[model samples]
Target: MRKITAGFFHSVDGVVESPNLWQFDAFDDELGALLGETMSKIDTVLLGRVGFEEWAGYWPNAEADQDFAQFINNMPKYVASRTRSQADLSIWQNSTLIEGDVIEFARELKAREGGEIAVMGGISLARQLFFAGLLEELTLITHPVVAGKGKRMFEATDPVTRLELKRSSTTSKGNVVSVYGLKPE
Candidate 1:
């Protein structure tokens, strides 16, 4: 079965929104290599409506020399959105719209033969997947700075989820990349 791995850029305070504002200075070649490695392992991308719209607007026009841009443009993308129609998703090449139960779709995707499915962004979608127990692994690239106000990666909730730390490494630029495997219930 293909593993669903969700990767997010987070702040010290657990903020996951707008990492570009604080993550630039902390981004180094080491971190870039790590991100590239992660991208190489995933042939499919899972995104939410917001992430799809934002990326579709820019990534398609991005320079061909940019490795990440090229990867995103070429990979098969599946966007989970109840509001977006097929026409909306077709704007991005190699993109598909997922309208029904996301968990069921994820299950079917995992059952298929593939390299890996990477959830690039979309905090709400990631949270939903985490709660549904569909995510097999999660990689949090935590920057050292603390963003005082932003959408947190994890919210206050009733039942807590447990994760086992698989590996962790720090880049020279102070980005702590931590990989976690979802613990069995």
Candidate 2:
């Protein structure tokens, strides 16, 4: 069985949106290596509708020679959208639309034989998977900045979900990368 990992570039205040506003200064070779290593393990990407549309528009036109761009462009992408049809998803190469119950679909995907399935920066999809108990791991590359106000990674809600910190490290540029495993219910 494969694991579902949610990776995010976050601010010290837990903001996950618009990393470009705060992430540039803390992007070092060490962080690059770590992100590259993580990407190497992912064979499938799970994205929400908004993220799918945004990435599809940008990545295809991006430099194909770049390793990250090539990896993302070629990877099998599953867009979890209630509205997007197969024809709509086919606009992007190797892209598929996931309709109906997302939780069940995610579980089935995890049961398949493959490398890790990654959920990156899709807050809606990530929240659904996290709350559904479908996500196995969460990796946050936390930068040394307070976003003040933005879409936070985790919002306060009902019963809190507990995560066991598996590993943590600080980059040369003061970015903290932490990996956490979901605690068993």
lDDT of 2 by residue, 1-185 (tens): 89999988999889998788777688899988887898889999999998888888878878654887789889999898878899998778999888778899999999999999999648889988987888888889899998887788777773687889999999888999999887876
Off by over 4 Å in 1: none
Candidate 1: deviation at residue 20, Å? Answer: 0.9
Report the alpha-carbon TM-score of model 1 versus the true structure. 0.95
- lDDT of predicted model 1: 0.86
TM-score of each: 0.95, 0.94
lDDT of 1 at 96: 92
> lDDT per residue, candidate 1, 34-153, as tens digits?
888888799999999998988888898986548988899899999999899989888889999986899999999999998999887678888888778888788898999988788887
